[model samples]
Target: MKLSQSQSFVRFWAASTTSYFGTYITSLSLQVLIVANLQGGAADVGWMNASRWLPYVVLGLVAGVMIDRAQRKYVLVLTDLGRGILMALIGLTDLFGTLQMGWLMVMMMGFGILSIFHDAAYQSFVPQLVPKDMLTRANARLEQSAAVAESSGPALAGGLVAWVGAPFTVLVNAAAYGMSGAWMASIQHASKVEAPAGSVRTQVKEGLRWVYRHPYLRSLALNTHAWFFFHSMTGAVLVTFALVELGFNESKVGFALAAAGIGAVAGSFLSTMVGQRLGVGLAMTFSRILYVPALFLIAVAPSVDSFHSPVFPMFVVMSGQFLYGFAMGVEGPLEMGYRQTVTPLSLQGRMNATMRSINRSMIVIGAPLGGLIADTFGFRTSLTLAVAGLAFCAIWFWLSPMRHAKLDENQIEGV
Candidate 1:
């Protein structure tokens, strides 16, 4: 539990958390800023958002394999530096009155590439730093910190946008990424990734083959990917629904989101205690059930009322977000621990990337579809579909061995 034991990881984690905080700020601020400033439509918004993650969909698996071969610390540092420079240049353009939609989109795409290496390398590095028994707790701590950062990031960005301006938020983000890069460069442990013994394609295939062939991994990926796809679809439309349809102010959504973050923080702490008591598989399955009810609760919320009768949708969104965030917190550490425990240290980067690639692909597919549905059937109907997708995903786990799951102690032993 004590970070002092891993001085390098502590430094790295602290800086990374701050970097995460900045990333969200840029994300929320840019969407609101561009939409407000550009006189743009839904497509513009969609493209702006897509540009940030599209690179990952294209580069994830390849990046993972590359990270497995490269020095992880260098990858992390280089990516952070790239983002920092990009942000600084962005800030300069705003000052020069040369900022445009095209410029912003290109910036997004470039930074997206940098983030690929950053994320792929970091996930791979964690297992190398911690003991097998500590992986869950380590991931939990990191996830908890991230949840806390995300909870505050949007509001901070929104507030800055409201007060001083939107463009300046990029400056803040640039500074954070710079600091993060410096911290990453200070890591003492060299990565333990093994050089591939064969052709690049063959080695990459080996990584993918191992992950998909494992029964637990296959079941876990299906359910997890489904959960994320639907969640992203709903998330893509939530702000539009809450603010546009329900007439709640922007600040109100921020408050509800912040409250849910508090719940996420609780869940991160609870995960270790719960998982240890219930056994990992049983605990993961139980957490999966929580999500179904939560999604249902969210889909059915009524708009805020005249009687101020608790503003059903507002409270519902808040409660559902809390549960969803909590479940995600619980699920993440469980999955990461299980995956890392079973995967060889050398292939960690590739395995992590392969899983991340599938997850990102789901989002890439879901976002535009959600945008279309919201544009056509309406946000409420789109939300209903999203909830249905999530409910249907539950079946993925049920028919498989995952439902009555058991994470045997034997799985942790290395060959």
Candidate 2:
């Protein structure tokens, strides 16, 4: 069935888009809160990033097993509700004047813990909603809506933050999550996965082997982990660089960052066509290659001091963000489709959790390290290192066995 015809998919899409919109708001607002309100710096941003993903490193594998054993739809609804309440509490805490850097990080840590279950269940739930043959198209539709949210969410966030302060902006995010949970709960379909007869350790090992032992999955996982580490470093410092070095206010930064969402929207429209024309693996490789020049543009962008008009610098930076967003949009759907199509229903949760756990774990380590480097050296230097590391990822995928793997090969070797 076409994704458009599936009522469950429509509800799922609504839930995802709503959550993504709110999440993007929090993404920018928290940074503004830390930098402008709390007077924190790059290292603080890194620690904040690290704290949010720390749970994935600590409990990701175990979360995978639990998700596989639980009902994914219920997991999705509960996690969304949990996140909504958490965001509301955060907003209230800040309103009361007790939301400090340390406390904020602690709240983010709690948020991350809930996210591990949400994300893992979310990915695994898709195959159950749609047929295998339509995976690419389904993911493309999802990415398109997400891209739209990405495009406008931050711009709105910037406005909201500037107009009402960053603390209150979080309440908007809380409402979005609450709505997302309601949308998710309205889906009519129900799903449950029976637990395998094994200990948790044994189940985790099985997932690890499935990911690391498969020829295509192994190469893809390694390269993706590398890409995430470097990509997250850039993420850790980009807000600071824009605000501090480029002299951009929250509104200007939001407008510039919104360009990425625009690019992603364009890319989502092109994803299935690109995957078909270039082949899934090569299309993914092309996206990775695009990251190099994109980051390079940002790394070499002139500071506001160097340019008489900030427009020139902002334009340059925005161009880089657009290219980066476009690349991600092109790759995201194809990669998710490829993984889900090949993995069995029973193993979907494990496969997603295993890969995502390690991927986010890279965020835990790389975000702080990047922040520290930016603090110790300079933003440009840290960004340059990220560029170099991403270049390695591009090459790794380009030369690895992954480039030759086709999406049509939907069967896992041992499955």
Candidate 3:
């Protein structure tokens, strides 16, 4: 069946899309709040960002076990509600003038904890909602929503922050999460996976063993871990570089970042076609190779001091961001579908969690490391390092087992 005609899929899509919109808004607004309102610096931003991903590293294995043993839909709804309340409380603290950097870090940490479960359950739940054949299309549709959110959320947040304030902007995010929970609750389907009889540690070990034993998955996991590490390093200092070195106001920064979203939307539209034409493995390889040059373009963009007007440099940055986002868009669905197809239903949550944990663990290291590099050396130097690291990742993927595997072959047999 076409994804558009599936009612449960539609409901899931709506809830996910709504949450993504709010999440993107919070991503920018929170940073702006820290840097502009609270007098925090690059190091502070890095720590806060690291706090958000820390749960994935800390609780990922346990969460995977729990998710596999429970009803995923309830996990989804409850986590969304929990996140909504947390965000609301944070906004209230800001309203009463009691907000502090330490408090913000704590709340972001809470958000990350809930996010770990929500993300693992949500990824595992998708296969239950759609036919295996339609996984690519379904993933593409979901990514399109994300692309839309990414495209508009930052620009909206920039304007909102400029008009009202950063604290108040978070209230909108809270509302979105609340509504997302309600939408998820309205879905008629319930996850039907029977809880496997095993200790949590045993289940976790099985998941890890499966991934480590599979050559294709193992290579993909390693490549992605490096990819996220280098990417996070660049991202950790990107806002600081724009605001300080490029001399950009919040609105211009938002506009510059929005270019990526636009490119993502276009890539989402083309992903399925590209996958069909080039084969998923080759498509992923090419897109990742292209990402290296895009990062180079951003790293080499002229700073504000290099020119009287910042427009030219900003354009260069935006162009690079656009390409980066586009590559992610094209690769996201293909990669996700391949993983989903290969994994058994019983191990879905654990597989996703293990992979996601490895990917996010990089943020814990990269965020602060990036911030420290930028603080000690400079943004350009840090970015140059990121470029080199990402180039190595691309080369690694090119030489791995995944580069020669065909996505259409029998799932594990191809590996």
Candidate 4:
């Protein structure tokens, strides 16, 4: 069946795309609000980002178990509504002059909690919406929409922050989430996965065991954990460095980051061809290698003193972001498709949750660690660490079973 002909897919696509736009906007604007408006610093940014992922560390396993047993469609709708309400509350607080950093942190925690469930359900839900043979294509199309949103949302957010302030811009994100919830609610399909007859611990254990025991998945998980850990460190310090050290205004920073979106869009368009030509494992490995140079580029980005043109430093930073984003875009669809294909439908939610929890756990650690390093040693030092870590992860993947693995051969029997 043509993806265009599927009404359910269209509705799901719309909801996901809308949410992605709002998410990117919030990701950029919220940090700006903290640093620019609230007089927060690197530590504050780190803590806030840590708050956003803490829920995954705490509730991810439980959420995964619940998602596997429940109706995923309702899970998606409820989580979207929950996020909308939470973000709206943030906007209201800002409007009423009570938007403290403490309150913002709390709200981010709420968002994280909802995100744990929403992400687990959403990743697991996609396979039910499309045929098995079309999984890669469906994931590519979905990623394409997200890439387009990423390309534009940051630029728009930068403009909004310049014009209306960061707090007011959050209301737009709130409204987008609300609209996305409504779109999700409009889906007519019932996604009822049978609940496994086991205690939560038993279910969780089974999921973890499956992931660790499978050579391909174990390699993927290890590589993902390392990549996220280092990447989170880079992200934690990036905005602060741009704003404080480099003297970049909100709009300039947004536009610089937006360059990644352009590369991501190209990557999404080219993902299938890359996967076909290089094989999924090789494609993913190549992408990981790109992260070394891309991050090093950002780490060594020249300050204003090093360049005559004021825009030269900004150009250097954006070039790094573009390369990094392109690598991620090319890898995203292939990895996700391979993961879903290898796992059984019944365990999909748990698998995604387990992997994500492990990934996010690193964020919980990396965020604060990055902040501490930046505060103690400085941004350049912390970024240098990130560059080294990325190189190590690439080497790790190359040496693991993943280097020679292919998507077609990764599937286990009876999955």
lDDT of 1 by residue, 304-354 (tens): 764365466678778987887787777777778878888888888888888
Error of 2 at 82 (Å): 0.9
Superposed Cα deviation of residue 5, candidate 1 (Å):
1.3
lDDT of 3 by residue, 333-371 (tens): 888988898888899999999999888889989998998
Best by lDDT: 2
Instruction: Please list the C-alpha lDDT of all candidates, in the order they appear.
Output: 0.76, 0.91, 0.89, 0.89
Give TM-scores for every candidate, taking all chains together and pairing residue i with residue i.
0.91, 0.98, 0.98, 0.97
Give candidate 4 regions above 4 Å deviation: 305-308, 409-415
> In candidate 1, which residue ranges exceed 4 Å CA deviation?
41-43, 89-98, 304-313, 404-407, 412-415
- Error of model 4, residue 127, in angstroms: 0.6
lDDT of 2 by residue, 245-360 (tens): 88888998898888889889988899999999999899999999999999999999887778877899988988998998899899999999999988888888889999999999
Question: How far does residue 69 in candidate 4 sit from its true spot (Å)?
Answer: 0.6
What overall lDDT, based on C-alpha atoms, would model 2 receive against the true structure? 0.91
- Tell me which residue pairs clash in candidate 3: none
lDDT of 4 by residue, 350-412 (tens): 999999998999999998899889989999999999999999999999898877666664344
What ranges in model 2 sit over 4 Å off? Answer: 410-415
Error of 3 at 320 (Å): 0.6
Q: Where does candidate 4 have its weakest 10-residue lDDT segment? A: 406-415
Ranking by lDDT: 2, 4, 3, 1
